[model samples]
Target: MPGFAAHSWSACGYSVQKVYEWLLGSQQRVTWQPFVWNRLSLPKHNFLAWLFGKKRCLTQDRLIKFGVITDGIYYLCGAQQETQAHLFFDCCYSQRCAHLLQHWLGVYWQGDCVYWVIKWRCKSLCKKMIVMAAISGLLYCIWEARNKCKANMVMKRPEAVIEHVQAAIRWRLQRSDFVQQKDSTIAWIRDKRLS
Candidate 1:
């Protein structure tokens, strides 16, 4: 067995491969960062919160220690359980965001997870990457907006967040090489009259 010092990194969820990457001076992105220090199943939830500066600036833990459940019954909208999945994907507010995304993509997303639809249905790698970025941005914005609501800040409406998510996705798509071409092709196909 290895010495205590050598084994300590793994205690914090650092794999040998991740440590090697860090030692090799890899540029840090959210996807490449170390796992969080909590035992929470939704590690991605922490990542999304951190990425968008949610629960970062404030001393929320102090408030939490005073016996407060910040997300009691979901402050976003009166939904079921206030879980990360519900807030991010299944909530009424989140479903509105998802509907905006669906309309923007011109496709129906049947699955629950964002990555599944992007990987399985996105026709091209570029579109898939764009969708992944869109998902990230939407999740980040939702967290930020949720935090604002928690702190009683001037927050935009949930519908506005859905519009923002759609706009961001469209902006990314516009920067892609094939978005215009794909749009033109679809329009042409749709507009053609039957003989």
Candidate 2:
């Protein structure tokens, strides 16, 4: 703070605004922010972080530990003790959803860890952002599905959740300015279509 220099402007001469923009433009932010913030809509993005972090008492295991509901193993499949990882990654319903989702996006997501997958580097920023959105959407929709299961409502199937994931990514891409400016962005889409 003592070395602060408002007198010295960025080389582009855009002042502090340029510095802030440059800071945010780094590849590291591209890897992480879309998962925690930016890209996706507000509150949905916020909620995704909370859900993926397993901070809420939504999972069956968490509820059981908290002594809430004692019976259900998992809301979606009712197969295994519901930890966040099991419910979202290992559940049959969710795994089917992920498979269909990968087909829809024309990408196979590697890695068992969500954070690892989210941080997986891509040459195309567009693809990176899309992957981030998919991860977030999958978690959100799964959590929402779990909630519906608890409420005795009609539960969405894996296909339906894949549709939700596609819709969310499509909507985000349609509005993303970065996608328009980045050449690498279009290559993933092009390759996806060709494949």
Candidate 3:
């Protein structure tokens, strides 16, 4: 063990790696960043991210498998099973949302899966935050819209869904002052300023 030093980077005098080892144990690895739990972060979006990363969100396929839903078909397109892959990536509704996001953020991305798209989308930290905010908001909006469609029999257009995402991310940015954005990026997302 390292001897305690008053100015040690870690309070217990262990290095950052040791802290990670202690927290995650020997087998599991944490995929999301530590900054994800910042005070101003959106709890709903964060929760959705947790479900999404775990592939535990109740997609139609999972519901059917659990005998909660009769059919595994996607409501949006009716052409494929509403598994996590279909709902978040392959279905037309999701693809339309992706296109709208790409246009709004002035970026081009291509991947058959959500994880791949998110992983290789951008290199800049500031841009990464913007993109993550967009993706997170979009996921929340899509899932809500899906539920509403089932309950209220109303399926929103891709444009309407994108508007919902815009509102959500804008509101979230206003609430969080931690992640500052560049002027150009702010202009791109159309947010007046970083809160």
- In lDDT terms, which candidate is top? 3
Residue 184's lDDT within candidate 2 is: 59
- Show model 1 residue runs off by greater than 4 Å: 1-71, 153-155, 170-195
Using TM-score as the measure, name the better of candidate 2 and candidate 3.
3
Off by over 4 Å in 2: 1-34, 54-57, 181-195
lDDT of 3 by residue, 1-195 (tens): 443343354554657776676556678655554323323336787788678877899998788889897977777777888888788867889899888877787667788434544466465655667677677777778888888887787899888888877887777666666656554655556643222
Q: Give me candidate 3's TM-score against the actual structure.
A: 0.75
Q: Is candidate 2 or candidate 3 better by lDDT?
A: 3
Instruction: Give the per-residue lDDT digits (tens) of candidate 1, residues 1-195.
Output: 354356577577767786676566766454312222122113354376454333242324334555764544556775564556666777778777766766655556665645453245545545454455555666766777777876795656766775665555554454555445555533432343212
- Candidate whose TM-score is highest: 3
In model 2, pairs of residues that clash are none
Model 2 C-alpha lDDT per residue in residues 76-148, reported as the tens digit of each score: 7877788877877788888887777678666687556457656677676567666766767877788888888
lDDT of 2 at 162: 70
Could you tell me which residue pairs clash in candidate 1? none
TM-scores for all candidates: the values are: 0.53, 0.69, 0.75
Residue 129's lDDT in candidate 1? 47
Ranking by lDDT: 3, 2, 1
Task: Supply the global lDDT for candidate 2.
Answer: 0.67
